[model samples]
Target: MSLRGPGGERSRWRWLRGLRARLALAISVILVAALGTAFVATYRGTGTQVRNQIDEDLRTDAQLVDSRLPLLRAKPGEIAEAAEEYLDERALFPLSARLFMVRIRGAGNISNLPDLSTAEGDPRLDRDVAGPRRESDESRALRTADLGFSTVRVNDEPLRLYFVQVTRGGRAVAEIGVGESAASVARAQSGVARTFLVAGTVTLLAAIALGFAFATRLSRPLRRMAGTAARVSAGDLSQRIGSTGPQDEVRVLADAFDRMLDRLENAFARQRGFVADASHELRTPLTVIRGQLEVLARQTDVTPDDVRHVDEVVRTEVVRMERLVEDLLLLARADEGELVRPAPLDLAPFVTELFDALTLTADRTFELSDVPPGRLLADEDRIAQVVRNLARNAVEHTGPGGLVRLTVRSLGQGRLEFALEDDGPGIPEEQRDRVFDRFHRTDTARARRTGGAGLGLAIARAIVEAHGGRIYADSSPEGGARVAFALPGFRAAGKRAAKEQAAKS
Candidate 1:
C-alpha cells in the first residue's frame, strides 16, 4: 500500500514547506553540497597520494634487491632460492612489503606469496599471467618498461609490483620483483575519509541549527504583522504590530501599517459622526413639516388663512431640508477631491460683483475695502459659493446697522487673500479652529431659529480648500470676528496690474 496523496506527493511532510523551513532547508542543502564536494575531492586526492607513496616504496625495495642479488653468487636456476635466503638472513624488506620474488631459470616465477593459480586459470590475476605460468623471464619482465611499476593480484590479494634488472660481472643474470599490498594504501585513504566525515557531519548539523535560528528571527516580525492584519480585518481597528528596535524594513512596514490603520479609524469615525449629524438635522425639518400637515388634517373648519399658514410652514421646512441635503452632497464631493473644476478668473471684477451681491443680503452696513487687479486660477462657481457662504455667515452673526467689511488684497508671490469681518459678538479664542467643522454652531438655538444648519462655514472651507487655499477665523480689528481665505496661483495680467496690486497692498 502507498502512503501518498494526489500526484504522488507526500502528505506527512507538508509542514516543511513554510518560509522558515524552506529557508533553513535551502541553507542546509547548499552546505551539504559544498561539504560533499570537498569530501570527494579530498578522498580522491588522499587515495592518489597514498598509492603514489606505495609505488615509491616499491621502487626503493627493488633498488635494494638489485644491489644485493649479484653478491649471492647463486646459479641461474637457484636465483629465487638465493634471494629468499638473503631476505631471511638479513631481514632487508620492511614488514609492510607483501611479496618478494625473483625469476628462476627456465622462465618460472617465485614469490613470498603462494602460487594460488590452477592449471585452468586464476580469475583474480591477469589472464595472461594466471595459472602455473611458464614463460621466458626476460619476456615477462619486458611487459613493463625497466624500473616501472604495475599492479597485479597474487593469491587473490592485490599488490603493486616494481621490476628491476640484476647484473653480475657486467652480464644480466636475473630480474627482481618488489611488491606491496594495495590494502595499506586503502587503509590510509580510509583514515582520512573517516576524519573528514566526522568533522563534516558535525559542521553540517551546527550550520543547520544556526540557519533555522536566523530564519526564525528574521520572519518573526512578518508573522506578527500578519496576525495583526488578520485581527484588523476582523474589525479590531486598534490592533497594531507595534514593532520596536532597529529601523529595519519590517519595522518600517509595521509603522506604515499602523499609520494606515489610524487613517482608517479616523475616516470611519468621521463617517459615523456625519451620519448622526445629518439625521438630527433632517429629523427636525421632517418633524416640523409632519406636525404642520397633521394640524391641517385635524382641523374641523379649516379656513383659507389656516391652510395658507400650514402651506408656508411646510414649504419653509422643505426648502431648509433641500439646502441641508445639497450642502451635505457638496461636502461629500469635497471629501472625494471632486468638488471643483478651475478656470482663470479676473479677481477685480469678481470681487466687486461678490461685494455688490452680498450688500443686498442683510441690513448691516456693508463696506468693501480696496480691491486689487489680478487674475486668479480658480473655479468661478465654487469661489462664488465660498464668498456667499462667508458673507451670509458674517451677516447672520452681526446685528442690524453693524459694520461688516470685505477686503481683498495681493499677498504677492502669485497669491491673494480675502477677508470678511463683522462688528458683532466675536468667535471665542478656543473655538476659532472648530468654527469650520460641519454642524458646529456657537449659538445652536439661535442658529436653528435663523435657518442656519451651521454648515455654511464648513462648506465655505471645503470650497476654498478645493481651490488649493486655506480658510481661517480670527479676531477682527473692528472688535468682532474675521474670517479670511487665501488663494494661490494669482497672476497679474500686466506690469500695471502688478503695480496696482502692490500699491493696494
Candidate 2:
C-alpha cells in the first residue's frame, strides 16, 4: 500500500514510471503478443499439414492395389492370396514412409502385417492379433461406403488407414486397406515448435533492446530541459537547456522553455535595480530633512525666522519624498494590472482643460492642436495623470517662453493618438527609449533636487500600457523632445456631430 522506501524516499525503481520506460514496455508487450500468436498458428498448421500428407499416401496405396486386382481376374476365394503375392513381387509398400499395414478382405481375410510387424508393445505394432478388434469396428462403421479413411490406435499411437472396395463385372470381389503410422507427423510438428521457440525468443529480446534505445533517444532533450528547470527553481537563473537538437516538437518546447527563463531573469534584474533606486531616492530627502533638524537642534539661541526656515526646508523635502513614494506605489500596482478602472471619457474637453491647467502652471508658449471629437475607453483620472506627466517633463526641459505644443487626433478603426512637443534640448537617440526606464535620466548631469526623481516618464509609460496603449519618445518638429502615445478602443462621433462639436469649440 505504501510505496515509499526507507526514510520516506521514493523507491529506486521509480525511473520505470518515466516516459522512456513506459514507451519501451509498451513496444515490447505488443511485439511479444504478435510473436506468440504467430507461434500458435504455425505450430498447429505444421501438424495438420504432416497428417494430411500421410492420409494422401495411404489413399494412393489403396488405389494402386485396386487397379491391379482386376487384371488378375481371380475368384473371390483366391483374391486375398493373389493380392499378397502381387504386393510381395513388386515391393509396392514403402517402409520408410511408415506405410506399415495392408489388409485385403475376400472369402478369407489376408494381411501383410506379418512382414511389417514390430516387437510386442511397440507403438507401431502391425500384427493381426494386436489390431483385429479395433480394425473390425472401423470396418463396420464404414460398411455402407465404397471408399473411406479412418484413424485407429496401435499401442496408444495413432494410425491413419484408407480402405477401398475392388469390383469386377459389376460384382464386389474384395476390399483393400492401407494404413500409415502418425509418428512422423508428431516428429515434424515438434521440430517446428522447437525452431520457433528459439527464433521468437531471440526476436523478442532484440525488439526490447531496440525499443529502449529509441525511447531514450526521444526523451533525452526533455530530460535535459527538466534538469535546467530544476536548477532554475533552486535560484540559478543562469541555467539554460541551450538545445541544439533536431527541429521537432520537443526542440520547440525546449526553445520556449529557455525563452521563459530569459524573461524571468530580466524581470528579477529589473526588480533588484528598482529597489536600489527607490532606496537611494528616499535617502536623499531624508538626509536633507535630518540635516536641517540637526542644525536647528545645535543652536542654543534660535530666532522665529530661523525656525521658520528649517520648517520650510523640512516641509519641501517631505513633499518630495511623498511624491516619490506615491509614484513607486503606482508603478507597483501597474505591474499587477490593478492600477486603473476605465470608463468612457470625452477627449476634446479633457485636452482643453489640461491646456488651460498647464498654461496656469508655468510661463511657456503653450500651443494646442485641433482636438479630435471622440470618446476614449479609459480611466479619466489615469489618462489625466499621463498627460500631466508628459506636460511636466516638457515644461521642465524648456525655458520660459519656449514653445510647447499638444496634439490629439483620431486614427480610424477605433483608435486615438496624442503627441506633445517642446522646444528644448532634445533627448539623444541612444537614450530615447531608455528615458522611460525607472530612475533613468536623459539629463544625467541635472541634480536630483532639480531634475526630480526620474520616474515621471516611467510612471506615464506604465499607466499608458496598463490601458492597453503604448508610449514612446522621439525628436519634435520644433527641434526638441517629442513624446507620443496611442490608445485603442476609441469611438468617434458622426460627421454631423463632429461638425457641430467643432463649431462650438
Q: Residues 1-505, candidate 1: write the lDDT tens digits.
A: 3544553564556548767788878988998899888888888898889898888887777777666664655566466555666667546455345566665443354455445211112233432354444543333433332455877654555567777777766666777776677877678778878988899888888888888888788888888989999998999988888888579887898899999999998988888898999999999999999999899889899999998999999998899999999999999999999999999988889989888988888898999988877789999988888888878878877879988898988777887898889988888889899889988888643545784788998999999988889999998998888999999979877889678666656
Count of steric clashes across candidates, in order: 0, 0
Worst 10 residues of 2 by lDDT: 137-146
| RMSD per model, one decimal | 5.6, 5.3
- Model 2, residue 425: what's the lDDT? 85
Error of 1 at 106 (Å): 7.0
* TM-score per model over all chains: 0.84, 0.84
lDDT of 2 by residue, 127-185 (tens): 23344335543333223223577776666667677777677676666667666678787
TM-score of 2: 0.84
Give the CA lDDT, 0 to 100, for residue 245 in model 1.
51
